[model samples]
Target: MARLLDLRQLDLEQIDAVHGRGTSWLYPLAAAMSGATAGIVISGGQLATATSAGAAAAPSGAAIAGAFVSDAALVLGLASRSVGHISLLYGYDPEEPAEKLFILSVVNAGTAASASAKTAALSDISRLTQSLVRGKTWEVLDRSVISQVSKQFSKAFGKRLTKQGLGKVVPAVGVLVGFTLNWTTLESIVDVADVEYRRRFLIEKYPHLANEEIPETFSDDLSDDADEAISVLNELAEAGGPDLR
Candidate 1:
């Protein structure tokens, strides 16, 4: 079982450290893009070369073989990229205090931002991007959403891989295909991180948003595990969890 994050135990210094670590989002974005491109380009080039060598494979057979090779390369690339990203976002030791603190902070901040947006009926892009909600307290962490983070990333990467695979079908188009694949893959990851961090920063900056209020369940799709986690977080809040200020 994955251990739950308990934010109440975090000291002020640890919170500061986590906030400071948000610098240079480009590092992870570039790393994921480059790692994925390396495998895909190499695979594409090899596939082209093999086809040119006049291998005695049927048309459909060659297509199937090419897909398998491309998929294998993409999977390997995603796996390699995930290791570094997981370490950066979730911490070197996931079960450690700092790691737990960072996870909880990200979850709570994101949950708070989403709920605030809905409650205020603020659907305008500028409202979401520019306006800050004052005096709204933190919400219970929505485990359903947080649990889907890995799945969402995988889905995004898979789509990019598929697009790149299609490009490789033309043969000898490895370099251009890899460039397109990398750009799309990194953009998806960076966009989510950018919005989440911006909300977190806004919440931290405004004094009124830091206060703890009564915690309420926000999601109708919550699992039994999610309910249990929310209860624990609410209990922590009642016990005087760390304030954003």
Candidate 2:
């Protein structure tokens, strides 16, 4: 239990350090491009890469929507890689089967669900995390459960894609809109991971309250940083102009 608690604290510290350092060049590059004179060239190239082979035959709007989803996935993948590092710090071997199962359990906990349903799932995952930390063998997740979680995640992703797609409709603002949407999506994915892990951390540390609800409030430290990052990205978007790039 002490080991679990220490690992949790270490995870939080590592996350803060990474965000504070801001080592990724993507955000800054995206911000700088907001005011680039070559906005059309850059946006066009991005759209072309994001779309399928039949992109030329598709309507311009469809192509742009596809680009937004593609870009969003790429951004989420980057965030996942960062979380993968934290998984290692938690003493999970990224390459081993048991550790992979542990990682998947945490990842699936973040899938979109109704408020009540999500709360219940979080509680269940908190328990599972405790078992894992205590060195219990990992039980395979039910196929039906996996399917349900996948469907929920897909639904959530679709909703976000639709919302961001709307912003891409206006040609003149497409570049800035794309950057903002991608940044926001990335932040959201990271937030969900943070919440999921933090919940498990709390449950492991406070076994007395293990049966009680672990509120989202417990994860506010990470969420606050996510909010700040989103604000910074938005400010950068607002500062950049098509003429400047």
Candidate 3:
């Protein structure tokens, strides 16, 4: 039997190699897969229409929106898994699975929300990133604290789902809307992961300079313009439409 790969045991160089290969195509593919899945699930069969007075009523946008939420969850989970690996590679201890999961969850939550709603989420992610770099123990965060954080994130996630549903209100264009939303969301998540991991990587490589704030240097390497992408998504969410073209 083929042995399972243990990501925790992999050294930085090995981890980098694995991540590079895995993420190069993973985000796009996952986004496409999730979008297609959402479109199909939402548009499949007669679920998109109801018979009434010998006329088929337009499919309920709410139904499509509901399907999108279920599909987006899977995409977010995949992105978070990559974020966890990057965290481990950047010196976070693998023994602290809860902490790692929490970080990933926060990052995903931040990526999902509109820019206007992202301030608190981003702040939380930054604090957690800093703590991880400082080697803080997970025990410092009690269950109540974790519960509260989880509740806040849950609310943010719900808002995001609502926005997504509103964006796909037109049943005729469900496929395109779903595709754009998933792709943009995953792209945003990847950018956040890159920044967080790169920051930690710099801190570990130059321990002497750890006390100094490192200048942001990874923007040139990002696949998408992060600010522009987030801004567009926020506008879309605010307008409650999917003019993503």
Clash number for each model: 0, 4, 0
List the lowest-lDDT window of 10 residues for candidate 1: 223-232
What would the per-residue lDDT of candidate 3 be over residues 1-245, giving only the tens digit for each residue? 12223443345576567566455357757876677667655654233454342225444567665676677567656666656655655555433534543454445444544343354444444555555557666553445544444444444554554465454545556667767777766666666676666655655555555567655422222332222222222222233322221
Q: For model 2, what is the C-alpha lDDT against the true structure?
A: 0.44
lDDT of 1 by residue, 80-196 (tens): 343234434422343433233333332222222234422322122122222223423334324443344333433433443454345544545654554554444444333333344
Pitting candidate 1 against candidate 2, the one with the higher TM-score is: 2
Cα lDDT listed for each candidate: 0.38, 0.44, 0.52
RMSD of 1: 12.8
Candidate 3 lDDT score relative to the true structure: 0.52
Q: Which runs of model 3 end up more than 4 angstroms from their true locations?
A: 1-18, 41-62, 91-98, 105-119, 140-148, 205-211, 215-245
lDDT of 2 by residue, 148-237 (tens): 443444444445344534555444565566566555444444455556655555555565655665555422122211111111111212
Q: What is candidate 2's CA lDDT for residue 163? A: 51
**Which candidate has the highest lDDT of all?**
3
**Candidate 3 TM-score, C-alpha based:** 0.63
Task: Point out the worst 10-residue segment of candidate 2 by lDDT.
Answer: 224-233
